[model samples]
Target: MRRRLSFFACLGVAVERVMTDNGGCYRSREFNAALAAEGVRHIYTRPYSPWQNGKVERMNRTLALEWQYGRAWDSEAGKASTLPAFIEHYNWGRPHSACGGAAAHAAHRRRKQPFGTQQLVIHAFRKSSISM
Candidate 1:
């Protein structure tokens, strides 16, 4: 939570209100006090109605499906250490059809591209895996 808070702090915006469900963490006095210190309001949703935070809930489901299930982890440490790398690839390497077949990093770059203008091209060179 601290890391995420610091990350949002680096964006230079004090959180005004955080809409969340009635999770224990959100209901904790300490967490509520922390939000007060940051001048953020806390808004809780009705239980069992996840549609209130549907975006985050859907993204969480995607992460579990796309990255977590059916994967082997040798150890807990290995899983923990690999998360950052996986997240980097998810943000930069994975192409999204929603973003017109471009990765998030690339999409951010060409966000202002003029209509009917040519955009940057990315090429991949496959390396041979076996030697004769």
Candidate 2:
């Protein structure tokens, strides 16, 4: 969670709040401390209520179907190696219905910043050795 927070910070995005299910990790003292240190509000969905976090749940489902179980991998390293490319394609190449048939980065660009600025940031991110 701290790493993700830092990544968003590097992207110049202020994360004011985070919503997650009532999972053990989210309830841990270390996680709460991290959120408190960052001054980010933590919200938990009602127990058994997946609808409260529908988008994340849907994404998890998609990831499971399309990536995790899509093919047989010879080793864990092989599977792990494909994640970054999958994420890149998912974010910048594939069209999403929720984004009005545009890629997620396109919708994010329209909503957040001009195309050139977003491209520059993404280019920098791609060039950097930062591993998520």
Candidate 3:
């Protein structure tokens, strides 16, 4: 939760609400009181409906692919220490197909809008025909 707060702060967005699963920590009265004090709305997803937070779920899949399956971390401590570094690389270095194959870091620098995979495939075909 603290990490989430820091992330939102870095992004310059005030979290007006929080959506969470029925985790014990989130369901605690203290946690709800805190949210109330901060005037941030709290939304709990229906059980078995994790897709309510699709973006986060997708990112978890990406993390599993990029780090959990691909990397070798022998111990918990090692994985914990490397997590921040991995997140930085994922946010800044990784190329997202949804973002037009451009590195996330480069997206902020470039002015052009992203082209989806279908657009890329069509563009490639057009280029080949023009060359022929």
Candidate 4:
């Protein structure tokens, strides 16, 4: 979380709040401390309510369907190696309805003031691996 916070800070993005489900990791003292140290407010979604965090849920589903399960990989490393490229394409190539049919990066580029008055929200989830 610290690393991610630093990354966004370097990009001139000020993280204001984070919203996550009732996950154990998110409830940990260390995680809460990190957010508190950074002056970021942490919010928790109602239990069993996925719709409260629909955007991230949709993103995770898209990632799984479009990249993770799109093809068969010979090895885990091979699949891992392709993630960055897929993320790059997802952000810069594919069109999104929220962006009014423009790619996320392109939409941000069109903005007169990028990151201005925008509150960055980080949603952390446990890492899961696919069993081959």
- The model with the greatest TM-score is 4
Error of 1 at 127 (Å): 40
TM-score of each: 0.64, 0.77, 0.65, 0.86
Query: RMSD in angstroms, candidate 2?
Result: 7.3
How well is each residue in 1-132 modelled by candidate 2, as lDDT tens digits?
778878777766777778877877678899899999999888888999989877767766666678878888788678778978987887689898988999977898678764434422211122112222
Q: List RMSD in Å for every model shown.
A: 11.9, 7.3, 13.8, 2.1
Q: Point to the candidate with the largest lDDT.
A: 4
lDDT, residue 66, model 4: 86
Q: Candidate 3's residue-wise lDDT over 23-129, tens digit each?
A: 67778898788778777788887989978866556666776677656677787576667766876776678888866898764765574543221111100011111
Candidate 1 per-residue C-alpha lDDT over 53-84 given as tens digits, one digit per residue, 9 for 90 to 100: 76456545655666555387677576657656
Off by more than 4 A, model 4: 119-123, 129-132
Candidates' lDDT values, in order?
A: 0.59, 0.71, 0.61, 0.79
Error of 4 at 31 (Å): 0.8
Candidate 2 yields a Cα-based lDDT of: 0.71
Q: Can you rank all candidates by lDDT, best first? A: 4, 2, 3, 1
Clashes of each: 0, 0, 0, 0
Q: Give candidate 2 misplaced runs (Cα > 4 Å).
A: 111-132
Least well predicted 10-residue stretch by lDDT in candidate 1: 123-132
